[model samples]
Target: MESGKYIIVTGGAGFIGSHTVVSLLESGYSPIIIDDFRNSKKFILDRLEEITGKSIVSFDFDCSNQEKLREVFSTYEVHGIIHFAADKAVGESVLKPLKYYENNLQSLVSMLKISEEFSVTKFVFSSSCTVYGEPDQVPVDENAPIKYTASPYGYTKQVCERICADTAYASDHLRITLLRYFNPIGAHPSGLIGELPLGVPNNLVPFVTQTAIGIRQELTVFGDDYPTTDGTCIRDYIHVCDLADAHVRALESNSDEEVSIYNVGTGVGSTVLEVVNTFEEVNGVKVKHKIGPRREGDAAQVYADNKKITEALHWKAKYTLSDALKHAWNWQKNLDESR
Candidate 1:
C-alpha cells in the first residue's frame, strides 16, 4: 500500500468499517467510503471527519451493483479495497438466506471484478470467527477447520474466502488478506462513533448497552448448560479499534501469495455471564438478565489464537475487556446525547 494512497472502504459508515476508517486516516491513508445506508447512518461520515480532521469522500451506493462499482473505480485511483459490506446477522440469515447470499456473495464478486479492472490488488476481507463453527479446542487458530456453517451468513463468508483464494490463485497480480475477526466491541476513544445495530442487537455489547439505557427490559443469557467454565458460551471479545488496526496492517502487507488468512482477536476468552458482570461493575448499574435456552446456530465456545498476526504483522491487541466496556459505555452516552 502506498504511504498516502487512497483506500476504498466499502460499508465504511458501518460499525467495523467506520472504526477502521479512523485508523486508516490516522495512519496517513485517505479512505473513500461506500455504503448503501441500509444498515448505517449519514451522521457517521460527519463524525469521522470530526475525528480525523479531514474531509472524507463517501458514496451512497450498494457494493453489489457492478456498474456503480465500476463507475467508482473509474472516478478514483484507489490503491486498496477493504470489503466490509455484508449482512451479518446469524439469526436473520437463517430467516432470510436469499438476502444474505444475494448481498454478501454478489457484492464480493462485484468488488473483485472492479479490483481486477482497476488493477487494485490489495483486498482485505472482514471475516468472522463464526466460520470456525463449534471449534474442537479452546483458542482456535487460523488453520482450524472451517466446519459446516451454522447459518447462511456464515456460509457466505466461507464461500467468499474460497472466492478470494481462487481469484488470487488464478491471477498473478492479485494479493488478498482475509482477517478473520472475533467479537469486535468498544468504540473510538473519543466515543463519537460506534456500532449502531438496527432493531434488537444480536451481539452482547450492544444488547448490554441497550438494557442499561432501558431500551430492552433484560438481557437474555443465551445458554448456561454448555460444557464450559461458567456454562455460558465463551468468546474472545477484541476491541474494535484493535480489529481496525489489523485491517490497516493487512492492507500494507500486500504480497503475491495466493491468500493469507489471519485471526484478529485478543487470544482471550470471556464467558457471557462474565461480560454481563463486567458491564454492571463498570457502569455501576445492574443488567437484568435471565438464563435462556441456547439460541440456534450458537457456538458453545469460540476464541482466537492470534499468534499468526502478531508474528506476521507485529500487531497485537492492546485494550482489555474493561477498557472496551468503558469505551462502549461512553459511546452509548454519546448516542443518548445525540438523540
Candidate 2:
C-alpha cells in the first residue's frame, strides 16, 4: 500500500466521493478534495472533517475549467486521482442530453490532460453499471459487451470508459481502473456524511427516507409493469461505505494491464417494491407509496457478477441492502434534526 500518498478526489464533497474520502483517510491516503458545490455544499466539508478528524484540503471550483485544474495540479504533488465529478441523474440527463455530454465529457478530458501533465499515473474512475444498458444476462460481469445506452447519463459513462481505454492504450504512463459501480446507497454510519442532494432527490433511498421524515408526501414506484419478479425494475444496491472500500482496494491493486474494469456491486438484485418495503420494515416506518407507470429507459433487471473484483482486487460488498437502508434512514434523521 502507498501509505500517506497524496490523492486528489474530484467531487470529493459529493455523495460517493465523501464516503470514499473517509475510506481513503482510513487507508492512510491524504485525499485533497475538489468540488464546485454546484450539486454539493460547503457544510459537507465540516461533516467530513468531523468524521475524519483531519482538516480537509479542498477547492471550490469546477473541474472542467482547464486553467483551474492546472492550478490544482501545480499546487499539490499528487500521486493519484479518483475522478467522480459528473452529473449523474438519469432523468435529468435524458431531459438535458447536451448538458450531460458537455459537463461529463469535458471534465474527463480536462482531468486526463492534467493527470498526464502532472505525471499522476494512477487513476480510479467512478464508472457506472449503466454502461451495460439492460444486459441480457443477470449479474452483469466486467466482460459483458457494452450495449446501446438507454439514457444520456449511461452514454456519458460509456464514452468516458472509451476515452480512458484509448488514452491508456496510447500512453504507457497511465494506470487506469474503471470501477463500474451498481446502485450505491447508505451513509458513513456516523450520520455525518451522506447523499445530500439538492432539491428533490433522484435516488430511491433518499426519496424513501425523505418521505418517511415527512419532507416528501409520498414515494412513487417508478414502474410496476416491467418483466421482473415483481413487475418493477431490479437493481444491485451496494452500500456506499463498501463501495468506498472497493475504491481503496482498486488503488492498491498491482496489475500488468494498463487499464482494468471491475463490477463493484453486491450480487443480489432487489426490486423497487422490495427496497421500499425493506426500508420501511427495517426502519420501522411505513412508506406511503403508489406504483406509477414504468419509467422510460429503465432496465428490467441488472445486478453484478462479482467474481473478478473479488479475485483481482480482493474486494466484495460486506453490507446488505437492509443494512444500507438503515444507515440511510439514520443519516436522513440526522439531517432532519440538524435543521
| TM-score of each candidate structure, all chains considered together | 0.97, 0.97
Worst 10 residues of 1 by lDDT: 1-10
In candidate 1, stretches whose alpha carbon ends up further than 4 angstroms from where it belongs are 1-4
Prediction RMSDs, each to the true structure: 1.7, 1.9
Residue-level lDDT of model 1, residues 1-339, one tens digit each, is 223588999999999999999999989898999999999999999999999899998999998888888777777778899999999988899899999999999999999988888887799988888889888886999988999877999999999999998998887688999999999999999999999999999999999998998889999998899988989999999999999999999988845576999999999999999999998898798889999989877788898999999999989999999999999989998898889
lDDT of each: 0.91, 0.90
Model 2 / residue 167 / CA error / Å: 0.5
